[model samples]
Target: MTERLLAFLILCLVAGAPFGAALMWTGNLILDFVFFYPLFMSGLWTFGGLYYWLHWERFWPWSPDAPPPTLKGTPWISILIPCHNEAEHGADTVLSALNQRYPHVEVIAIDDGSTDDTGAMLDRLADTHARLRVIHLARNQGKAMALRMGALAARSEYLVCIDGDAILHRDAAVYLAAPLVDHPRVGAVTGNPRVRTRSTLIGRVQVGEFSSIVGLIKRTQRVYGQVFTVSGVVAAFRRGALDRVGYWSLDMVTEDIDISWKLQRDHWSIFFEPRALCWILMPETLRGLWKQRLRWAQGGAEVFLKNLPGIRAWRHRRLWPMALEYCVSTIWAFALALSMALWTTGLFVALPGHIQVETLMPPAFTGMALAAACLLQFCISVFIDHRYEHGLFRALYWVIWYPLAYWLIGLLTTLYGFPRVMLRRHRARARWNSPDRGIKAPTS
Candidate 1:
């Protein structure tokens, strides 16, 4: 509670900076759009988001679905793990799922035609655990198909899906299943994902990204009764929801986004459970991270393109908000990138072309305001997720790098991905190599 107040205080200070700058009033639209607008939206969204979650129970005290206490004894939950060339990492995930605190839990591990040792690892784990079911596809299929196969093999009504690279918290399954049994129309529960790879700067920064930006936005959207997409790392679903949505899409680049839209279209509500934690590995190199994000951005675009026309329909009104959010975010990314590009090229032309440094950078006042806003957002986010801290505070000095670097990266990804999806004539292929798992040291 004290931390929440501190976050609020920081936001207030950040807000003051912009209004303080407004006293100087240059009347520059570009300056306002590039700097002030982002800062303003950041504070508005962050504060509003925090307010909803912090007092979620009080203001909107009653959820349409009942509380977990009303539910009966232990229910069966199948942990469906889809893998492809994940190797030993797949086994680690299976072990984590089987170790859940929940009673009557089973694991359905699918080896999606991996050329590597992932299949063998699943077999080895299944050999010792009777409840762990292993399904090996003869051919390589997409994640959507692998999940579909695993879902078919699963006997339980409730399903928990985690990436093959993830390690579930001991109580994750138990907490994730609560919404399903407690609520009437709850179809899916998105879990909190923590980064396990902290060996590099990129990895460490992503920890802040997930907790601060991704997690905060999720909580905010959940309060608004809609979410852009569920994190693919760890999510829980009622088997009935999957059935209603016709399962996952084999052609969509991102099965998670595609399926999420499909479920909501069917009138099933999704929930975000922060207590349901799953730690997972992430790409440490720029190249690897770029590939991962591009696939995500592109998948989002594909989904948007498919549903663009339907967004205005009364039946699909819920989708209009998400679609608009994506469009606005995309525009923001491009604008940020263009601003950076002009800065870079202007460096060569600055002194020679007689452009002042003030023109090159955001006005001193606006720059300070933007920086404060970002810091405030990060502080609030990191505070909420401090319990999962991994060198989190120590990594604070590096936080400033995010706004400049990630924005451009997001711009490039969106540019590359959106076109790839739009121009492609063929179906999305099922082929994918193993994701970079960072420089992980082997544990005996």
Candidate 2:
């Protein structure tokens, strides 16, 4: 049934393309009305729907007991926290690591010359926690440099890099380490990160977005061992595998993504464990979110461009295919936005008499289809994330507004990111900014 439906959709697209081309050539109003615009929109929505359907199984977190295979000896794990002006949250992040349920773990907090009381706070935390260690840099080195220093100082077999603002679940460390215990080929494990504070509208919307993204897309990527970005929020890596790639590269803004690609190129398996969760705060305002996404998009483009040669060499290969898939997906969103703009303009300039509303039915139906697609996506989001407070109805509302807002934001970021990528501009400077971790400020 799925294959037949897929084939039918393909035929519709293939047949519609030439019809659209012929209508444009002949300047036939009826054919133009019947074919091009509607088909275009349908194609976009269909692609989205198909993608969601294909990965729908990942919408829920796996059962907790589905543990990674065990190892013979206890492996010492080092937790590296790179802090920059995060005095406000550094202590809490360190404390969270110290509170990990894992028995064989070492907590190392590197204060990247923070101007704030971050260094002092870490000093105090280190004194309190026997397993906690602190490293203070003489100057403000970027996160990549700080991570390198910390990783080098690590005496463990596995190193986990976590942001200063991120708080790991009690079992997160153990879950992260489990993969490496048995899968000798697995170089890294990525944890599912959730937005900690969803008080504001912006925060709530982002919560939904993050849930669907990690729950669906990242999990699908995991199936092929092609997970792209092992988020810096909470990810574990084999020290040897990282050392083999010569440690984290400081040139790019997304060191996480860069390292992931390098690891894949080196034939190292990367796993995404949806059950291994960490909670971190997301940008709470549209402006803040824009800046954050701009940085990410720009960083991604930089990685793509810088590694173009290697990507080309590995075309048709695993990571390369995933990379291309991402690129195409990004481009399609922008294209759909552009096409909508064009269609709206065309609607204003009508060519004369006996206009039939029925002639416009296809485009209208296409719009409805797109809306339904969004609705289905929303359903998935709510189903997966409905465990949190107000999750169901809020997810519905977000689904309604998300596509428009997401594409607009994506378009702006893609436009903003391109030039920066071409000019080699670094927004965050490969450094980590400590988020405000003061006990989630009273929302009321």
Q: Give the candidate number with the greatest TM-score.
A: 1
Give per-residue CA lDDT, model 2, range 95-133, as digits (tens).
Answer: 778877667889988988888898888888888788988
Candidate 2, superposed: residue stretches over 4 Å from native:
1-71, 314-316, 333-362, 381-395, 425-429, 432-444
The reply for model 1, stretches above 4 Å from the true place, is 1-28, 57-71, 336-360, 388-391, 441-444
TM agreement with the true structure for every prediction: 0.84, 0.78
Q: What is model 2's C-alpha RMSD?
A: 8.5
Report the C-alpha displacement of residue 444, candidate 1, in angstroms: 16
Give a tens-digit lDDT track for model 1, residues 1-444. 543454344334433333333344432433456566567666865785687667762343222132322235678889999998888677778888998756689999989989989888889889999999999999888788889999999988889999998988877786788899888699999998888787788887777778767887888788777777888889989999899879988888888888888888888899988777788888889988988888888888778766665566798887777777777666555554444544566667653222222353677888888888889888877666665554567767666567676666777887677656655556656555677787762221
